[model samples]
Each structure stands twice: as C-alpha cells, then as structure tokens.
Target: MGGLNSNAELRRLLEEIGWSPYELARAVNRLVSPDRRIHAKTPFAWRDRGTVPRDPLPAVVAGILTEARGEIVTVDQLWPGQAHKTEVWLPAVAQIAPDRWLPHDTLALLKEFRASGKAKTHFAVSGNELTSLAESWAFGNHALMSNRMTAGQGRITPDYIDYLEKDLAELRRLDDGHGGELVLRAVVNRLAEAIDLLSDSSYPADLGRRLLSLAGQMAQLAGWLGFDLGRHGFAQRMYLLGLRAAVAAGDKQLGALVLSCIAFQQTWRNRPHDAVSIMGTVQQGLRSATTPRVQALIAMREARAFATSGMHSETSAALERAHQALARGQHDHDPAWVYWMGPTVLTSEAGRCYLHLGDTLQAEQQLAEGLANLNQDATRDRVLYGLSLALAHARGTGGRQDLELACYEAGQVLPMLPEVGSARCRNLIDTINAELRPHRATSTVRTFIDKFETMKKAKIC
Candidate 1:
C-alpha cells in the first residue's frame, strides 16, 4: 500500500463490482486449497501498490469477477502485463437469437468469418455457449431455405455437387495421413470456394440444400484442422458457422455430427463437464437418426469426458455402451463420416481414456492392440496413439525394464513425426520426454534423449 503506483485496472474492476479489497481476497481464498489461502489484506497490495499475485491467484480473481459480473473478466484485463501467463482464457457466451439461424443471416456470418482472418489470440468460447448452441441445434426447427437466385445467376447441377463431395472426401483422407497443419490451408481454400458457390450460384431447391450441406461439411473440416493446430478461437467460430449451414440445410444428422466435433474439442481441452454436457445434447437430439456407428462414437466421446473427470464408474459404463453399440454392427444409413469409426479406433480411444484415468496397464493393452491393428497408412493416428502407449509404459509400475520399453515405443513414433504435422502428437511426445528426463542416467533413456534432442535441432520431432 506504500508503493507510489496504484493498480488502476484492478481498482476499477473492484469498484464496478462493489467489492472491497478484503472481499476480493476472501473470494479468491475460497477457490484455492486451504494450504494456499491468501491473507485478507493481499488484495489491498494488489489494488493499491500495483502488485500482481502469482500464477493461479490472478486467474482465480479474474474468474471470481467474471462469475459475479456475468461477463468475461480476463487476467490480462486485471493485470495487463501478466497476460502472457494466462494459460486458458474463455470469453463470455453470446446468446444465439432464433433469427441467427436464417439462411441469409448464416450466409452473412460466413462472409464475416472469412474476412476475419486467422485468430490473433488464444481463447475458447465459454462452455455455456457451446452447450447452448448444441441445445439449439438438437431441439430447434430450422427451415430449409428456398432457392432465391435471380435471373442469370451461375447455374449448379448434381454432377458438380458430386464432384465437390468427392473432393472433400479426398481432403479428409489427406488429413488422416498428413495431419491438420499440412492440410489446413487446403481445407480452408475448399471451404471458401463452397461459400462462394452459396453466395454467387443459383440452384434449384434440392441442389441448394446439397450445396449448403457441402459447405457445412467443409466448414467442419476447417474447424477440425484449426483445432488440431491449436487455434481454438478460430476453430470455435468455424464450428458455429458450420452449425448454421447445417441448420439452413435442415440436416439434423449433420448438425449432430458437428456437435460431436465440438464435444471432442471440449474433451481435448480438458473441459470434461462441458464435453459431457454437449454430448448429452447430441445424444438426446439424435436419438432417431443415429446409426450404430454414430452411437458408438458418441458413447466413446462420453467415456473420454468421464475418464478426464476421474469418474471411473461412469467411464466404464460409457465404454461398455460403446462396445455394445459397435457389436450391433454397422448399418447402411450410417453417415460416410463414420467410415473411420471401427473397432481399432474405438480401442485406441479407450486406451486414451484409460490413460486419463491413470490405469497404465489398461492403457498399454488397449493402445498396443489398436496400434498393432491400425492400417499402415494411418500415419497421424499411429503417431498419436503410439505416444500414448509410450506414456503408459513410462508410467508403469515395472522397474527399469518399463523405462526401456517406453524409450523404445517413443523411438518408434519419432520416424513418423516428419510425416505427421499434428501439434497434438508433438505435445504428447513432449509429455513422454518429460517423464523420461528424470531417468536420463539410464543408458537407454540417455540414448533416447540424445536422439530426441537431435530431432528437435533438425525440427523434425
């Protein structure tokens, strides 16, 4: 309090909330562990002396303010200089008006999204926003837009739509092999072309619906690629735009698919409750339309969220549900997107769930089986799951032999890294590397570390 400078930003925020410094401190302390509680006077120093508290306190204070104000109150807003330390920032959820789903409105939204360029900041839309969007998609009735092209507009045909669909399929295959970073630009370009067709071409009602569906698919792919590259804000926008296109096209199944993608993103970001909530909306909304494959996918995603949240019983129940769904066999009505959903993929995901649940033996068994059965061409999946297996080994209860096996598994993944451009794969590798670092004195661990360092120097891994 004796410092010459005052924390004007902190003071202003407190004033707006009508909170005294002590109250702010009290609120923050309530959110932390008892051992880490702050003194009641701590906020006075922050407000009057320009002292920013350490890592999690600033985040906690900002969260308290955000909940109280019912708006986003970020660490950067409260302490501008500490923005870089913010690990995750979630914006306030915007309410989606019913009119926002209109075809023309959806088109305008896509146009604006295209012009916005790449996201400059790293942030996620609030979980409430995601859940709300999913609920709207599941329960709402969106009319199929009538064709509204004037005379002399560019004409479209089913053949052209077929060609576009094939192209998108090829793009999906490319993403599977080469990962999102290598394929994102191509997906973005294709999505732009789809948007152009929607805006500039005149088509009959059927063709218009197909075009909208195609645009929605491309937008989902772009969103997925953006997510894979860790551009979450950009990904969220793309997903919402895709949802609008799906609604405009009156494709409930596709809307469910997009919702599942959003759920997966939430799960990956460690927001298990949000992921579970979004999946619940998806399951409830798609009850009549879901095929066995689709059912399996949803159950698997729910299992993942449950595992992340340490709900062991719930996770096991969800996994059993996924297995039962898959055992029911595929149907002709299954969407083409579910082509990649099979026993191997399900097993691999189960392994990932077990890893999250800290069941290393189960993780090792499932991941190994999935890797053994995986198609050789599935480079990105192989790399990601391989690293997960390595992590399982590194965390095993066995002695030095387990550490050696972990090094070997990680080494197998390194060669594939150059072909796979997934940031997720790299992040997993980094985790395994961190685990092995403490055992560097072991000969096998030392060798693996040297090789890893060489790859880093060469920008290969």
Candidate 2:
C-alpha cells in the first residue's frame, strides 16, 4: 500500500523471489520482535530501522525470490559468486547473525551457558568428562595457537570475551524470566576439568596461560549465574576460583579483569564495602600492570566501587585516572592479553561511575562517547556501553521517556546479559523503582521493577 518499495530493488527482489512484500516484512519484523508473532503488513518503514540487520538480508531477499520460483537461488546468481560470498560474510567483529558461523563448539557452548544464566542444579564434578576437558584445555591446542596466534592471542581473548558479553546483556534484559533456570552442572563440570588440567605442573607456560584465562572466564560466568540463582556461597567460591586462575595465568590483565569484575558482583549483594575492598586490590594489582590500558581497567573498576559506596570524591578521582590511563593507551610493553582495554572501555565504565555518583549528566556524557566508540565485538564492552547508557538515563531523567529509552538500550544487550554481573545495574534499577514509586505516572517503571524482582526471585540466590 505504501510507496516505500515501488519499483525499487527491494520490490524487484520480492517479485524475483516470489515472496509477497508483506511476507518479507513479516520475517524481518519477527526476527527483531521476540515477543511479537509474525504477521503480514507489519510495516518496514525506513524510519524504523534499528541496527542494520546483519548483512545477507539482501541475499535472503534473493533467497525469497529463489524460494518463490522453486529454484535454488544462489546468492552468486544474484551477485557474482565472489561478491555474494563477500556480501554475506560477517565481519570478524560483528556480534549477532554470524554467531552460527563460529566453529568452536566450546566457545558456542560458553555463549549458551552465559545467555542461560541458570545454576540451580547442583553441580556434580566427577568422571571422564571432567578430566577430559581439563586435559584438553590445559594441554590442548593452546600450544598450537601459540604458534598460530602468537602474533596476538590477546586479540583473540577479546573475541571470546565478546561471545560471552552478548549473552550477559541478554540475561540482564530478560531481567529474571529464566535467570536461574538453566542447568550449569555441565559448565561446572567442565570448569572442574579445566582446574584439574591447570593444576598439573607439566603444562606449558603458553597453554597454561590460555587455559587459566579460560578458567577465569568460566568462573566469572559461573559466579554471575550463581548470583542470579541466589546461590551466594557458590557464586563467591567461583569468583575466588576465577581470581586464582587469573593469577596462575601470569596474566595481570586477566587478574585485573577478575578483581574489578568481582567488584560488580559484590555490589549486587549490597557489599559496597567489599566492593571497595576489591577495587583497592585492583588498584594495587594495577601497580604491576605495565599496560597503560590495563591501568585504565583498574581505574574504571575502582571508580565503580567508589561510586557504589556513594563516595563522590573517590569516584571522581578514579574516573579521572581512568581517562588519563586510557589517554596513555596500551604501550608496546603491555601484554597481549590487555589488547582490548582501550579508551572505549574506559568511557563505558566512567559513564557507569558517574551514574552511580548521581552525576547523571556526567554519566550521559561519558556514555554517549563510549557507545559511539565501542567496536562491534561481543565482549563485555559492548554490553557495558548499552548498560551504562541505560543506567545513566534511568538515574538522569527517571521519567517515562527516560525509562523507555533505558529499556530499549537494555534490550540491544539481551543476548549478552548473563556475563554482566554488576550489582550496580540491579541496584540502579531498584533505586529507579524507589524514585518512581511516589510519582505514580509511569506504569512502565513499576513494570521494570516487577520484572527485575521476578529475576531476583527467580535467580537461584
């Protein structure tokens, strides 16, 4: 009915594929709208485009034509073969759409584990599976990667981190619908396996480094899931394990990652003092971080801890340090493991710190910059970018418009929700709820509070 597609390539493609323009629109809409059932005439107004659908939709448009004609519609037929391949192939750094193309079964499994955020099932760590995974992780292809990615394994670490990152955002966005419902016995079992392998003295340094980081990563994820599920003891144990593993890897960057990371987890339990304590450790640990970017990481985390404590002075100091460190950038002497600790990362955490300090304006300023600079990797950075935006808006405006904006920012992060264990985010929402209760205007704020409550209740903790 609309002239949006008249005689255009899109319209021609629709005719070529035999799909009604209406049907194509429905599929696109359905993919984006998880809650909405697909229906024709769902409108694909140009004004409505969110993040551009990861590429290949044009090919899908071709495929639609192919499907319509009952013929194999090769993308190559539509575009030249090389051109077709180039068109559909995602950037190595792109977040979704190409998720299915990643080959590492273990990585995908980790992604699934994080996205699920369930840990209610009592984990049993025994038998062949445990020992096998440990052995492989501790002694497996890490050496091969040493030969392969020695040029930059730190670069790769960020990628693995990204896979988990997307899942964390998704977990947060879902609030608590299935927050603590998934079985994590398998993940725990695997971690135990990694622990076994890591403990062996025979492990090579490079392999040990990689395995330890993975172990730390696993522990970090497990702890969050545990928190979500309300298993505080278990969560704490896992965080401790993450700490130990990160240290063993001789990866100060990862240790910094965990130390500051645990600060977020501590904030969830209302342990702002403990959060501050952890941040102190992070600062001390940063002393040894030759990497300027790693120093930024430490500063950002410390700022977060300070903000959670409502210590505006300390928070400001930390935020300033974070920026200064980022300005210093990653020196050549910094370990490859710290490769992703760039300015964009600092901006994200700085935004978060400012938000918690009740400086919503400052928070928004940093957040906008952070989101603008964030690369399209799946790592925690992207999730945090969106999360910082949400928290900033939530605290800044606390109005219906702000709440809706926060929710939308939070939604882009649904796929990576679980890995983000920031008690700050949870507390921020609760704070927003308290602020909104007296207003009695937006049911949406109440709805948000209720949703997070379900998550809290549903979380195994």
Please list the residue runs of candidate 1 whose C-alpha ends up more than 4 Å from where it truly belongs after superposition: 1-5, 8-71, 74-99, 118-122, 147-152, 397-401
Instruction: Report how far residue 114 has shifted in candidate 2, in Å.
Output: 19
Clashes of each: 0, 32
Candidate 2, residues 1-461: lDDT per residue as tens digits? 33633324444455565667477766556333355333454324321321122244434434434323433344444443323342332211122121121223323333433443243111111122122322222222221212222222223344444454454434333332233434345446556555454433234446546765676666766665675555544564465455445554555566566556556655655556767866675555454435667777777777777888899998888878878877875577764435556776677767777776778887888888988887654344565467667766765654423667666666566446555444334444455556545544667655655665666677721
Alpha-carbon error at 397 in model 2, in Å? 8.2
Query: How far off is model 2, as Cα RMSD?
Result: 20.2
C-alpha lDDT values of all predictions: 0.80, 0.52
Instruction: Residues 26-140, candidate 1: write the lDDT tens digits.
Output: 8777656798799999899998988878766777677677655535677878888754444333332322353467787887866655655443222355556578778877787
